[model samples]
Target: MTSAYWPLADLRIRSGPLELRPPVPAEYEVLADAAAREPHAHPRIPFLEHTADTPLRRGRRTLQWLWSDQGTWRPDQWSLTLAVFDQGQLVGVQNVRAAEFARTREVRTGVWVFQDRRGQGIGAHSRRALLHLIFDGLGARRAQYRAAASNQASLALARSLGYAEDLAPLTADDTVRHFSLTADCWRTRTDPVSTHVTGLAPALFMFGIGHE
Candidate 1:
């Protein structure tokens, strides 16, 4: 479906200099170009071997999973895939998922920034935006995040956002750290600063996560 008819046309979240919005079908080329330009810096899973350099053939396979039927549209599952924009340019992608969402009321989040965009607090801003939409807009009870032990930045971001670290297996190169944050914890923290989002509730639920 065209983005206009895809249901999340107006869905957006802004945090200071960042703006998170659903990708329009017209944006597929933009995303593809971005993916092709810098194919080494964007890692989808911290512990997985899915790097930007994983061949367009392999990349296409991954994209299919994210954009196809087996992807984000199941009734009990939802995914919000956001195009992270900084000053009007698509710099990265952020994904939030909820399985059995309507019943579980919980979501998990993951994000990646372009190589040149790293270390600028954009990751933090993008994450906070999703958290706001989940906790404030969707009434989610909790949000979970996992970071590879080697990814100090992600681990740090999770901690900064008040996610309590959970005990998990720590291995040589596959260490995974799980963290979670609740609505009450988020409310007690300072609200994220944004300028693009207003009435995010209706748009949030209708969009069903992955498209936006």
Candidate 2:
């Protein structure tokens, strides 16, 4: 499909009450609000290098991230950041991305929920939806996760999903941790998040799924 059509916009993955889709105006606004209001006291920010100090800053950063990733997708490497919505309201962001996916058949995941929405199982359901997309929709063989120790929530979620601790220099900080799951390892979690992926048949070639 052409960029004019933005075929990715048709893509949607749903699990239980959660849905993951490319960011639109409404979802982007929620992310900015969450970033600004969600406080992180640690010196090491939870995200790569994002700040939620102000609404304008958060808005710019989120917009930049969404547009840049959308513009740069390729079969060999890509970043697909989906907006996570709960009951039609934006709650967080979930990502499934990788490089040389055709040969490696791997993808990595990262998730973030609004500060006020935490502990309500949004993170878990969102990531499970991503895994469903990666492995089921995109045919990925492996999925990965890395989080700093200070990000206890992320680490805990990884463990709960049967991700195995892995040896990797995640960052300059030693507190950072890494984890991975093979397709086999992935089957263990067995969460009841029944997945539904649509708008994928036409996009299979781009993701190297099936005939690609």
Candidate 3:
């Protein structure tokens, strides 16, 4: 499972009881199927499941999107869509993305946990793993998150993680709330979730950063 050409495939992050790693093409269908089962998990999210389409079609669209995301990665702008697993079982997907990372050192993240697994704290563990990857492993200065104002669960999670409202420009949709956490806030936090990241040293270049 080693990728000589794309070391990102080797990246792994562990937090609590979860493991987050880069998704392989063969597992795209599994991710899509998970999403298909909970199409309306977040009504405002721009996933294909929101459309009035068959599950198969929605899954197909999800596959295409995942493929496109991996294919379009670049140093200046890229998205790392990691497949989340709990004790070796596919649970969902978590995405952490950045633009002009070399200069801004900021990243944004998104996640989709299946409806059946919503209340079990899986999302929190998944996000803690991702935050560790960006702030600790990648040396990110800030991490941002946005959720529809109506999505109380997501907003509550952001607040719980010590994220504060950010005065960034409003999106076309005013319903989305923005929050950001600075590296100082993250590092000095009293309640830290233990996390470990591996295989990232080899993929540093792909993320537009060098070993510090």
Candidate 4:
């Protein structure tokens, strides 16, 4: 079980008060609990199952996407979905994903924090830590944010991180507001928080980082 293919299981990203790592089997149940407690932000996203439904189904739905994403991954086009933990509590999940990333030098991320976990700076630095993994760890030239126009929380977080506006389109009536951050711009930001990574070298190679 030890090979270059193992970054999905081993990568870790950490900030002052947050940590990101792929969850094990036991942790998935904890993620389910976090999901049961969360008030999902946008229920319109086709792929997401609504958490406000039945209690029994809530936990089932919460674990489905992660397991499915794991099953569908490929190095050329895949999402590194990490469980977000604060101190020791599972609070949310974060994803850094791409297609033909070695050639494109571009990546996009998705994040979610539970209802109770909102309002702290977790959302900001969590994404920041992912950006660092993209730009600094994986040699990305830029990263994109396609936020729901109706999701003021996501839009505000993107703005606070110094992302610039870009044009994008989401599903019908679900307006997609776009934003982007370049490697250079990422460097100049006043360092609201910094990130450190471990077990990322293998992940970088899986991403075709140095091969390009």
Task: Compute each candidate's TM-score over C-alphas.
Answer: 0.80, 0.87, 0.91, 0.85
| Greater-TM-score candidate between 2 and 4 | 2
Give the alpha carbon lDDT tens digit for every residue of 37-151 in model 2. 6555322233325532555665566667777787888877888888888988888888788898989998887787877789999988888888877877777889988877877
Which candidate achieves the best TM-score against the true structure? 3
lDDT of the candidates, in the order given: 0.71, 0.76, 0.82, 0.77
Residue pairs in collision within model 1: 14-194, 22-212, 39-52, 79-209, 79-210, 80-209, 80-210, 81-210, 81-212
Q: Would you give me the overall lDDT of model 1? A: 0.71
Residue pairs with backbone atoms closer than 3 Å in model 3 (clashes): none
Which model is ahead, 2 or 3, in terms of lDDT? 3
Per-residue lDDT of candidate 1, residues 43-148 (tens digit)? 4343224553454644454465346522447556766678899988888878887787767888889887776888998888888888887887778889988887
Q: By lDDT, is 1 or 3 better?
A: 3
Q: For model 2, name the residue pairs that clash.
A: none
Cα deviation of 197, candidate 4, in Å: 0.8
| Tens-digit lDDT string for candidate 3 (50-90) | 64667776677778879878899998899888989999888
Candidate 1, superposed: residue stretches over 4 Å from native: 1-5, 37-48, 51-53, 69-72, 168-174, 195-201, 204-212
TM-score, ranked from best to worst: 3, 2, 4, 1
Give residue 113's lDDT in candidate 3 (0 to 100).
82
RMSD of 3: 2.1
> Which of the two candidates, 1 or 2, achieves a greater TM-score against the reference?
2
Pairs clashing in candidate 4? none
- Each model's number of backbone clashes? 9, 0, 0, 0
Q: Residue 158 lDDT in model 1? A: 93
